[model samples]
Target: MGTLGVLGLELVQMDTPPTTAYLQIYTEERCKANCLFCAQAKDSRAGLTHIARGMYIPADLDAVVSRLKMAYEKGYLRRACIQTALYDKWWEDTVYLIKSIREKSDIPVSLSVFPLGDERYEELCRLGVNEIVIPLDACTPGLFDKIKGKSAGGPYAWERHLDGIKRAARFFESVGTHLIIGLGETDEDAVKIIDELHGYNVNTALFSYTYVPGAQLVLETNKEESIRHYRTVQMARYLILEGIVAYLDMRFTDGALCDFGAQRDVILRLIEDGTAFQTSGCPECNRPMANETFSMMYNFPRKLNDKEIASVKKELGLG
Candidate 1:
């Protein structure tokens, strides 16, 4: 089969627009895992962006960087981030490519590489990388394996990913992970995971699960469930960051987020604290159009406008 080519343009919002840059390119190879919910998983061979949520369409690496360079030189985007997929240990080329861009460009570079050990991470840091994102796609071991099927040796070790994040955070000013919703994980599960990451001083970017064709788990998820998950995660982040609530005090009933050990009004205040607007992945990394659709935003490219914040709050009955 022929290789997939670069796709279309997407307009996005940023907490502070004209400051952060985003670009997502194809991995150029299929992922080795058999993650049931993903399109790029083994045997699927579907489009690249289809495999993961919150990633933009593929683009010619050089062209995208060229445009970003111009933007940075003109003071449009001060920082740029490059995120890629990992089928295994075959991402050396990707690292090299990002390193090359970092060398020639004045903008800060961030990478969301796989859980390669400290050796590769240390190398990237030396190469002028400002941040790294290790997406611990699942919170628990069983869920990790159930969704992200084992290959080579096995799916990512939960403890190991945490250890890696903790270690990376200590050295880097900004370190992050991506957590997708609707993975059969409870709202509580998602909240607790982000809470725990915050405890370790690791930042989290939350994503609502996106379904595509040819996946084993093709069942439709309740829209309310997805919205609820996003709101809870967004709120949990605010609470934790504001020191209003602890992870242990958060409560859930039957997979729904029930309480954050705070008054209702306090939770609302936290949501509006712009804590939700804090960039999730990497320092100065704002991925506009990262999730494909503007309305179905995985991350708010810009700070939430009055309309958006009010709309989301109303949907969750928080308004």
Candidate 2:
């Protein structure tokens, strides 16, 4: 039996149900990369069952695929996302699994894995994969090195990941990247990276840094701080991605974002629309409570109403 996300299990059991379903498979082998925030890290106490703040229960691959196919046929499963841990032969194994799923179901697949070169990209394209996500989890190179690079004794290099993102953008129409907030980076750092990735026509998936129970990183930020920082970054990301603002025009005060380079009215109008606060991930995927509690959500899986919009504005200091 392979591990499945909470949503995946819900789909299989037909619980409250989600519009989209994630197969949410992970590589069981121990990861070579020792990312400090990751539960799969070599030194982390978390095992294969714990990932991304959710518990993954064991289930058979074929049975999971069957359930996914059934859900798709019923119009409940819109996409399948496969997350991979860095391990020896992981690439080959992931490729095989992708092919297996494609053969059984027609659900569009999104793969979140380590940066692979052009040959592998072409192979995935040939296999009918929808998109590729290479997570440059840290916003700045300094932070990256400290948590996921040489300083952390990890295998990932900042330069190499950037190159891979560029390459993937050239190959896939819907290429994407992942960034984790609260990793010792400021709002400016996060927005700058988002603006840079926008240049390549690449989209980004934002995740808040949630401390896993057995992971090394301590969960220290309070609710108000986490909400404020995340809301600011999300607004900045949306503005940059939509081409409504540029990083050069943005003003920062001591590494904190102070101005979005747009007029006050324009910014307020955008904030009121509330699309900026929704979850950011693969196309058609809205992962509710993926990184925060339901009461204090970092990203809303659904559209925000008036009250919710007001709360988001308050958190962003716009109210």
Candidate 3:
């Protein structure tokens, strides 16, 4: 069972659930990367089921596919996403899994995997991949190395990931990338990357760094600070993506965002709309509670009501 299944979107049990109809599947193999922030790192003791803040039970692919097919037919499933962990022959396994899912259903597929070259991407496009996610987990090259690259003895490279995202933008219509906040990066660092990726026409999925026990990188948690920073970045990404604001229009002081270069009323109106605070990812993909708890939501899975909007305003220092 996948995380959604465990969260009560059970394919075999639930006839109708009010969750996003996207099915997420992760490769069972252990990842080779030793990223300090990741629970799935090669040296981490965290179990596979606890890697992504959700539990996944190992099950037969055929059975999983049967359930997915049922969900798709019943209008409970809209798309499917396959996430790969780095391992020997992982790419081969990912391709095979994509083929398997395609053979079984006509639902659009999105793949999150290690950076690959042009030929491999072309092959995936031919395989009917609807979109591709190449995650630049850390914003800057220095932070990338320290968090997910050579400083951590990880296989992923900063330049390689960027190049892959650029290539994917050319090949795939909907290219997406992931960014995790509170990874020892300043607000300037985060927004700069968001601006650069926006230039590449790639969608950015912003995530807050959720503390996991026994992780290599031990960091203090500041709820107020984290919420402020995340809300600011989320709003910035949404504004830039929607063409409502540009990176040049954003101003920072001492590496922190101080001004959006837009009128205060205009900014408030945009904030009140509340779409900026929702989960960021592929279209129609909402993994509720994937990063934080319900009361202190890092990414709202649905639109925010008036009360929720007030809560968000308080968090953003607007109320």
Candidate 4:
């Protein structure tokens, strides 16, 4: 029963059987940002326990490497990801850990660190890191501040995160971002952000906001928010990457998605490909059990079965 840390939440062993895919490891100590929604926020005394929700204590560097080696040898884990927080001195430790992991593990490694500069980005790329995740939680800066209020760095500026993503895309082979739903943003805004990310060839992983038990900010997330965001993101992904439609071609009127600007058949065809299903992002980064089970599953985290895809297509009205 190895302990896995996320933000400030520590997870026990898996409640369900472990799948033979990617293994998520908490590779850092505390986070530097106090995103209001985060359970790891310094002032947040939330009793949340989720693997992807927050940062964890940085395990010994050598031991993390050893554990990964042993896990890989036993065929328990395939790809490994190191999810880090934005600690004050976090970058040095993270840089070292990334280098160390590259030296030991033959498996591809991905990182979820803060928005670092071009130099560090290039350094990691040179050291053989394949993917990096920068989580821009809200659609806009004001929303970002409201959602990630009064933190140490105040709130993450949306433009800065975008700039980071742009820089990263130029350097790294795979650049990704995380967008959380239920933050009062409309589905159109969510889609726009996804389109914007696609412009940089940056992949996005979608999340639904799950309230921590004792977090400072007490916002309630609706289950419908997750469903709508998932459906819209799936659509946005196909539209952007497949070049089915442009963001300007879509419009939101009175809270309804309008102006798809493409033929009904074309849109349906793309949607039918199951690319519009919940499994979006880099190769093999499906994080099942990544979010709260009680809420709507934000990302399917795996390939959707036929019935599930049909259900999503029907729900999205992609006929």
Please estimate how well model 1 matches the true structure, expressed as its whole-model Cα lDDT.
0.66
Query: Which candidate, 1 or 2, would have the higher lDDT against the true structure?
Result: 2
Task: Return model 2's CA RMSD, one decimal.
Answer: 2.5
Candidate 3 C-alpha lDDT tens digits along 64-179: 66666676667666777777778887777778878887888887788887788899999999998999999888989999999889899898889999999998888899999989
lDDT of 4 by residue, 1-319 (tens): 2223311123555544222233333423444567776766655675333334532344455766766666666655566666655656566767677777767777677787668889889888887888888888787666776766443355467677778888888888889988777778877777788788788888877776766666656666555545755676567666776787877888778655765667777766665666566555566555556564734555565556677666676667663
Model 4, residue 288: what's the lDDT? 58
Model 2 lDDT tens row, 108-172: 98988878889989989989889999999999999999999999988899999999989988778
Stretches off by above 4 angstroms in model 1 are 1-20, 25-27, 49-60, 87-91, 151-155, 272-279, 292-298
Worst 10 residues of 1 by lDDT: 1-10
What lDDT score is found at residue 317 in candidate 4?
A: 65
Model 4 scores what on Cα lDDT?
0.65
Lowest summed lDDT window (length 10), candidate 2? 1-10
Give the candidates in order of lDDT, highest first: 2, 3, 1, 4
| Ranking of all predicted structures according to TM-score, beginning with the best and ending with the worst | 2, 3, 1, 4
Indicate the residue-level lDDT of 228 in model 1: 63
